[model samples]
Target: MSDLREVAITSDSSGQLWNACVWDPFVGTTLMTYKGGVSNSHCLSFIGRDFLISGDAVKPLLHVWALNRQEQIQVRMVCPGKVGALAISPDGSYCVCGIEEKLHVWQVATGRLMAVIPRHFQRVTCIRFTDDTTHFASASEDGSVIIWPLCKVVSMTQDIFRSISDSAEPRYTFSDHSLAVTNIFIGKGGMRARLVTASLDGTSKIYDLASGIMLLSVVFDVGLTCVTMTIAESRVFLGTIEGKIHPLCLHTPPRSLDYHLTETEKQNVFSEHTKSITCLSVSVDSSMLLSGSLDEQVIIWDVPSMQCLRKLQHKGSITNAFFAIVPMNVFSNNLKPSLVLSSFKRRSDTENEESYCINVLNSERILCDKKSENKESLKYLAGQVLQLKSQVKSLVGANLELYRGLIADVWDGHDDDEPDPSFESTQEVGVHKKRKIKHKKKRNLET
Candidate 1:
């Protein structure tokens, strides 16, 4: 199996039409483009292999496009204000839109309004669904994050409104951030599921989903705009407002004991962009990183070396970029790694042009070497060490048993009156005792 991956980008700049494209980073070719959707805002989400959902920033309408059929479907919803963020469930059963301080849930199949959650005090910044689709979380400018049960939220009626004193609160609410919460990311399944939240307060916090306790908290000098973790969740990559990418290790604490640590030691700060970094995405294998910035540049970074593998330019500021896998059948005979970038440049009074474009670039060179073989070799060595330890333990036990048997046999044969020969010999080893015994023997012989 190939460890390399391709990316798909969706972006809109004209505020009227959105474009989706797939890029092969290895060959630097545009594999596919689907540009029929209408979106005036930064809302673009891939629903599945066939459909995409986009929302208009200027209106309360959500557009759904079928990539196969080249058809569009519009779903209208009542919102108190403009939609700020949107997220779709993993199973494609529901779509949640964050409009102002409230959240609206819609059934994707039936186009029916499901429920409304009026919780946050400020504008919602981002929403994310868990990997299992059992729950979802939303971050807001109020500096708080709320995890909601999907089942409970879907069962809620449109008329139901949660009050401030309601006993049925959200599953978890994180309020450690002092500024707006910018992004929320949920880790893949395991014994301890983790949720990482980044904020404008210059801090990113990792929380245990089961216990709601923070396991790690890392503070940066600048506000963070986005975050994504590798598949293993051992390291987290953060995009900051200063157009810098920060990678943090979650397994160990920093060497510095200072509470106000400015920068992480030995951390590679990617500073290619001149503007704030808007979004970041990591590959499934965790070997590649994609970052989109307001400077209209999308960078493909080699994760291990922290080197810029490829730099893709855009005409407009980048809205979003993703590191997605392109199916094997999507291209011809050759299968190479790819990257997708979405950029949008708003037109001025004179220029009448579409503001959105999706660029698919094939990687000219390989980004990373596969580390699976190295991991397997380490595992084999560790197993051998364990086996040797067990063998040595067994040998020592057998030798101890034999020594104990010899001692028991000697005790059984000895009489109490005749002191043990070993003990008497040990007592006669001193030079003064030996001389005194010799003199006594000589005196007895003379007599």
Candidate 2:
């Protein structure tokens, strides 16, 4: 598609030779490619549209890159263990990664460790941050789902001993699944939101976040791998291990404990996948559905027709795919990234400090060597320079105003101070008494 407002992103998830690619889905053309480590399902995240990150399946490292650069950032964050699932807060200030069965939280800007939580008994399968970024959910192979308050998780590290015991305690823990929970999704409205989770137990459960109770449960014959809802919350789409996508209507309220999902074959038009679906996503307007499968194909379906519009066949199993509505110049060259993570530590030690400095210097050297390719690239760079200059001007004006206020206060205080112990207001007691008498005479006249 020629629409610059939205872009299709998918990774060639080979793990070893992985590359993040952007595509023009309608025309079936590759527009851009970002070279770096590959990631699995629930492992890819875009940090505030400035940078992209993914955890390498084979290493305990997270690969990062600026959206303006094709190569991964010189520094990669090494976690305590290999990251299986990763999710960054919507604000991009903090990120929580599921490394094996444990969850690690870190401040993205400073590379500071915030907490270590081992609440899951088995390997984590998915991690998702709520829309408000106030809470996060982690699902695991142990058939448990835990919801953690973002503030409570960080509050532990403020105290030394309390952190040891409190870091692992979550806000809410649900053990409703008899099998491993495959994925979880939280809708809007913060604490009063709704949580939808899919499990391999042939059921998808909905929970009310406010009350911490199961609202409804949908059961099917086949095990579910992933689940998502339409933009309007009209229906829920469940991807099965049997390679079929089931659409469950949500018209009926959650009055019963369980309900069987039913649909006729004539309406089951999204049964094109032949393998277990790994992940699922919907468009911004919910007009299209995107799904990736272990069969190495990413399908784009028209939600209205429930027919496949495009099939993006990959060299490796499709691990992650999603639609992003971004600025028109998001992929433009020579656009400097505003993100800073040079201190994103490997293991939080000083021995690697020198190496990090060297990497930073090397990246700077490469950036300085860049030459504008064409008029369009040059135009974009010039626009960026203008934007920076405007920001600088605004900051300078603000500082000048602050300094003027300080200078005025100093001059006013000096003027109010004693003038060689000869100031009229301080020395003239008779003049003060006359003013007081005038006030008394005015009060007497009023009486």
Stretches off by above 4 angstroms in model 2 are: 1-4, 15-18, 156-168, 253-255, 263-269, 327-329, 346-447
Tens-digit lDDT track of model 2 for 103-170: 88877777866677878899999998888888999999999999998987866454432443234568
Candidate 1 segments exceeding 4 Å error: 1-5, 12-18, 36-42, 69-81, 156-168, 253-267, 327-447
Consecutive 10-residue window with the lowest summed lDDT within model 2: 353-362
lDDT of 1 by residue, 1-447 (tens): 232456646453442333555566545456565555344333677664445666665666555555443345343334445678888887666777888888877665544455667889998888888878888889999999999888777652432332222222588899999999988889887225899988998988888998988877776777988999998889888888888888877676554422244435425677688888887888877888888888867788888888888876665666667777654433434423232211111111112322323243434434545586677788999999999999999999999999999998898887545668888778767767889899999999999
Scored by CA lDDT, what does every candidate get?
0.69, 0.78
lDDT of 1: 0.69
RMSD of each: 20.2, 18.7
- TM of each candidate vs. truth: 0.66, 0.73
Best prediction by TM-score? 2
